[model samples]
Target chain A: MKILAVDDEPLVLRLLDATLNGLGYHNTSFATTAAQALHLLESSKSPYSCILLDIRMPGMDGIELCQQIRRMPAYKTTPIIMLTSLAEKEYIDESFASGATDYMNKPVDATELAARLRVARLIQNEYQRSAHLEELNRAQIEGFQPMAPFDFAEPVQIDDVSRVVNSRAMENYLRQLDRLGLFKIGVIGFQIRHAGSLHAANAPEEFYGILADVAESISENTREVNALIAYLGKGSFAAVVPRASQIDRRDLEAGIAATLYEFELADLVDSTSDIKVSVGTQINGSVFGNTPDKMIDLAVRSAQGMTESKPKALAARIWSLAG
Target chain B: MINSQETAASHLAAALAEIRARFINDLIPLINEMEYQRVAMTDPALAPEAFSSLQHASHKISGMAGSVGFPELGDHAARLDVTFTKLLRAPYDHAGVQAALDPLEAFLSLMEDILDEVL
Candidate 1:
């Protein structure tokens, strides 16, 4: 990839140029001043793939140079990586806001720089590939079935663990499904008595804690299962687990219910009523097959039925098929 | 290097870009530990030791940054170090250090802006 390396320090500029040339990338240019860098870009007919800039420069600093480069039509979308030495948070935020593609610390490592450049290339490639695929998909979808805008009911599974719940006492249940070992499964919207209230109040801190405690209890009981669990907001949570799988639906539901029951929310329970939950599971899912964006959409949809807001008749239904 | 528009606006951006790289690598990892130190330092019994540790860290950062030509960051760090130092020297001025935190956070936010600009 073609790169324009800018740094006020001669030693740094030499090091960068040498590193890139040594790494088999020969198309490199060096500029000690921001004005010189701008002159080079303005004069060159060929566009650079990336710009390596240092913040401190003699006349026009790197930041001004970046802005000038961005304003010019030739280098608008070209990625710029800033090289800095200070480890202050304010500096990081400003760099990103100013339109830098990435930042690297001084005493720069050649390998890390190359890796970062490669990642940037991959992202750019993926973006181009996706844009092309999207056009194709738009046409293909028209041939298959009518498309509908996606909608979600609620978030599911605050904690990162699996559970089985069979207690008929609760209408909504939340549990995680991780049989495939590909992605995390989180089921949310389960409360024995106050599920509706918690859901309505937007799952207050007390309710969220109850949800986390429930997942923690299940994880502690099973000891065999481990996961990272956190509430996703509302009466829901997301649990990242080892895998996803299809299992005995009732057993899975009951295990979740059992784990939830161990949590002591005496105050919340007393203030309202018993808390119960309904569980949902994904029948056929693989992390590798489904991208994170698609998987999250599916998981959120899978947990929909566990909400009381669904038509009473629909809320009472169970998954006949493992889907 | 202080042009009203370029340095005030873009120069700061450049300066921030320089610090951004370090923030991601060094500061983020220490966040959890900083919180721990804050808790320990704010405690009634261990306040002195906590204040001293904070002062030491801030002072070291202030000195190091000053040597490297980041007078703005160095000045802020020195102010913070002094505020903490006050707490150590005079127990009654415990609240003095809290006011310095905003500037630090603001500095952090400035760095974040640079990152957004570049990345």
Candidate 2:
């Protein structure tokens, strides 16, 4: 399998090269700086099987580089292993936050490194294979009936993992919003981009972990607006963030984006970060007069517009420091 | 031929011995740098930079020592790293500095004991 190793230290790189070779991992590439790594990745004809990145690099540290790479559609879920001497808890957390699949301590053991590389590649490939099988199975089912939306007699507990209400519940909530009158309620939809692929290769635990983090984040960020968040199947999550005062669509969008990113890719793949948010407001006596399902469809349509562009479509407002 | 598993194990033993020899040789420059940091960390005037540098050295050791078959050494370094980090962030005062330095000095003493055995 092909691999890319990036580090600022020549000695470190040499040791890595030696270790990989001793372990029989020969199809390897090297980069001395994060810029070089980016340039190499951008220019490659075929994607590398996995990446071994050094966390402490000059001119764009590995964490920043990982973030940038995660934004790229091509390598979003490619296994990224941080090979570095920076073993601090915060550094490790930041690496994972930025999309590192695994973190290996420096002076990497050749035997261990080889085994990790083997496993990382195997898991990635296995995930893809299983995903395809699931898709095939899904398509072949004759007269398949969709599962019913979950029903809860009691309010979902604070500790319950499922954050988003099911499709039926969403419809019920939409009815409430409609009857409440225009400007009294609002709804925003978040579609987890590439949901199929996310569930394709990952365990149920991982899939649910992301759902839980998203639920927790939405609850935390919109506590002020008292947003009621619900999970709509097929990777779509929605929240109704009501505004007492006239709420700028941008304000709702900003808070959602920031909170989502805070818990976004800490464990999920890069594509998981491709989530898109859409806002539907009722203001100026203009009620969004639609059924719950249709309102969701409208929200999805708004979100669909952003998904076409990706990562950038993630947020409505952005400010960048000028080069 | 060194093709048998036993022979391979011997070969691995030999290679590991060579790696340890190199490790001991390379560790000096790291210790030398840490000494400079130790001076800064102890002196109230230079404590900030030295404290940071000491923690950096400890982090490096923490990351490296384990692969060299010295997990205890790595743990000691990691603990020291945390001490330095805590001291650096805590309110900088004489008593606070001393509290931080006590753990810092203990970690250093532990490192010295480990290094002496290695040497």
Candidate 3:
């Protein structure tokens, strides 16, 4: 895969060049400044598959550069990994917030770099598959009914949703936090009450619109706290927040319900929408036992285990009142 | 194929060694600038800028030194970087700053030792 690595240090760039070459990735380019990297990105004939960026630079630092790159239509979902020595929690938070796919601490180990590159390759392959499916969709639109590009159970990235990240990036952020001994975090999951029915009833675009609305509601509700939300397929979303932020399960559910109610009233959703969300109890990350993946799984399971009976009764009451 | 693989591995090793040697050579001037910054930190007016400069240099060293096989140096630089970052963030009088930077002497000595061994 074609790669672009941006770092101010000449030695680091040389080392990366040699390391990448040894690992059989010879089609790599280097830039010493964010400006230069932007120039290369704009002028290159072919799009780069992955990019490695340093967090600290003289002008227009890597976070800003990552944001700028995300603004470009072609690179919105490209795997931009922040490779730097700044292991501070703030930098990690900002890097992911600015649309970085992964963050790797410096003093690069070949084994670790190879593993990260492997993940990047997987992401790139997924993107390519999606692009191919989209082409198929366009071609079949005029002939037969177009197939949905994504499976109903697939966790597609929600674009243009503030504070919402792709599932992989969320996992990476959690893993990095775990590695850095920042275990004082909580995970909570939210699930649509009748997602299967909704998926069956609505068109693909409508279902996606529903998901985006849900994501925006969740993001708005959690705005007071530092939270990173990710949709984990099957109409479930997991959010990681600082443990200090006291999140009442009932309050979050109510907030989301109110927001969806507003969306329905404003015709932001279909007229028949009875969308409601149930929130799980917070799963706190402890120093000893829980892995990041395990935390996510347990939170999702918690949400899944919640009986939708109460939400259904409540929605019925709300509908009766509305009538 | 095995011979070719072996040749490629050896070539990479040689390239890494050359890069490490160049890194060590480049550190002499960096160490000199850091030492100058260390001296400059005694003045209250220059201390913040000096601390900022030291933090930047040490951060670079902390990141690169370990990758080139000098992990001890990397660890030391990382510690220094942390100290300088803390100093830069908080308002510190000259004496407090000097007290915090007491570890610099040993860190500089370590860099000099590495350079001497390399040269």
- In lDDT terms, how accurate is model 1? 0.50
Candidate 1, RMSD to the unseen true structure? 19.1
lDDT of each: 0.50, 0.61, 0.85
Name the docking class for model 3. medium
Scored against the true structure, residue A23 in model 3 reaches a CA lDDT of: 87
TM-score of 3: 0.90
Q: Write the per-residue lDDT of candidate 1 for residues A206-318, one digit (tens) a residue.
A: 54456556655534433343333333334443333334433343444455544454454332223344344444454233554654434444544565555432322222232
Angstrom error at residue B95, model 2: 3.7
Angstrom error of the Cα, residue B107, model 3: value is 1.2
Off by over 4 Å in 1: A127-323, B1-119
- How do these models rank on DockQ, best leading? 3, 2, 1
Task: Give me the displacement of residue A25 in model 2, in angstroms.
Answer: 1.2
Residue B14 error for model 3, in Å? 1.9
Residue range A242-317, candidate 3, lDDT tens digits: 9878998866776777678778722223334578788898999998889999999999889888865355555554
Query: Which pairs clash inside model 3?
Result: none
- Give candidate 3 regions above 4 Å deviation: A131-149, A265-272, A308-323, B93-96
